[model samples]
Target: MKFTEELREENKDIFQAIFHHPFVRGLGEGELPEDAVAHYVKADYEYLNTFMQLYGTAISQSKKREDISFFQGQVAFVLGDEIHPHRNLCEYIGIPYEQLQGFPLPPTADHYRTHMKSVATDGLLGKTIAAMLPCPWTYQEIGRELKEEFAPEAEHPFFEWIDFYAADSIDETVDYLKKRLDEEAEAASPEDRQLMKEAFRKSCQLEYAFWEMSYTKEDWPIREEVLK
Candidate 1:
């Protein structure tokens, strides 16, 4: 099997947990609390902010001009589609978008972002793309799955959210990522290919933590009172 296929098979348990998480389940039912969604929007903005940097790194490091073009296109997608919509979400959640930007990231956000940076900055080009693949690919997959199961109406709270992920654009983007990853791994030896799988696996695990953190509103251990 190809590395991406193998990675999915090896990590099927975590994938199941993510696909079946209460947060995702709630999204399907439109039963999730707005507060949780609010927290997620805030944290995810921070995530996308750092995510842009990683894409920039990938663009700089890529050896092929077409690879550079793809990464640059992804950067634009992040800004235009990924990040800009949060402004309206901020409005819906009754917080100014500017205020959402000011909130400090929770520990989970930092850990995932830090890991992404480390991989994109330090890993092989193939592995760096490997690290980046899970987010879009997995999200769109879940979105497509739930969109069919829920068939949410236009007015549903989470409908637009589902639309974002289930868009044809997302599928196209993830397909590009997957194609690149497959091509990169095609000629790689067994040992080097394993590194790509490991990177993709770790990113998938972090993807789960990211959703859980938003739903649980995970907080850092330090207390404000104790700090003083």
Candidate 2:
């Protein structure tokens, strides 16, 4: 079966909900709050740091030496190249890098970290890849939307970040991930497929929560006034 078909069959609800979300739809059209986009970039960078650390630990624990080395390389590329470049996104949104680093991660972020760690440590590589698939795919899809909807206007802060990730590189990232998932799936057992599906669904739900957390504000009068 085709990869897209397999994804549809395995994650039907998640795919539908993501496509229907207002923020995601807006992101597709190059419309999102500047603050929100900045939050996403910062959040994603921090999450990668934690993820890579866990991936490193998992690789160290693996008995398969060659597989351990492969995972190590994957972690390095994702951290050193893919994730590190956007570390300064906090500055663009008027937040200091130190402040972003010190800020408490939301529950959604914690959930994502836990899920990835679990997959990396205990599940098949294919399952782990499945768990990681939604993030890049979602970003690429949103980027496509932004390119189509907001390229001409290009004035919004959110659109600025959107355009950068959704560019040609994002397509390449998605293609690479798709190929990885296919290869992993071909080698996976039925149990591994089930594990991958479960982890993928959980990760998607956490992703939705991550976005929601960014938009939510605590009811603090002083903070509200300051925001104004």
Candidate 3:
């Protein structure tokens, strides 16, 4: 089996958990509280900044011309294409898009960013890609599956969110990333492949946590408790 396939098989349960998470379900049903949606938009907008930086790290680590180009293209996509949904969500909720630029990262977003930064800065391109893959990869799956299952109407609050993630363009990116990851795995030592697998699994786990964090409108517990 391909390395990406192996990674998926190993973490299939996490994917299911993400798909079934309350935030995901709420999105499909358009039942999420506005506060939760607003928090998600702000948090995810901030997270995308770190996401783009990781792609830059991937580009710096690239030796192949095509790899550099691919990473650069992804960075552009995150900036140009991926952020539109967040912007729409912000407008829908009356938050200024510019405000998200300074929005504080909640605990979960901070931890996930820290995790990706560790791998991205570890000087291994393959591990960085593995760490980053689950975001787009799982999101594509969730968007497609939710759209299919819920058949959300255009009036649904998150219909655009679903459509953006379920787009053919996202599928193409996931396919290319999987192909590239497999190619990287073929040239890797067994130890390196093992590390890649671990990175992928950890990312899958974090993906689940992200949905839960959004669903709960998670905040810094210490701050909340201190104020209480």
lDDT leader: 3
lDDT of 2 by residue, 1-228 (tens): 955458757766766676667666655554556666566665666787876786566566556776577567768667566643354345345665555554445557766888887787774566666777777777676566556765734455455556656778667656765776686767778877777777777877876777675655212234435877
**Candidate 3 wrongly placed segments (more than 4 Å):** 224-228
Residue 74 accuracy (lDDT) in model 2: 61
Residue runs of model 1 more than 4 Å from their true location after superposition: 84-92, 224-226
Error of 3 at 125 (Å): 1.1
lDDT of 2: 0.64
What is the lDDT for 183 in model 1?
Answer: 83
Task: Please give the lDDT score for candidate 1.
Answer: 0.81
Candidate 1 per-residue lDDT, tens place, 100-215, comes to: 76567888888888887877766567778888888887889788878999998888767777788899989888887778788889977888788788888888999999889999
**RMSD for each model, in Å, please?**
1.9, 5.2, 2.0
**Model 2: residues with Cα > 4 Å off, grouped in runs:** 19-22, 25-42, 54-92, 152-154, 217-228
lDDT of 3 at 61: 89
Better of 2 and 3 by lDDT: 3
- Whole-model Cα lDDT of every candidate shown, in order: 0.81, 0.64, 0.87
Clashing pairs in 3: none
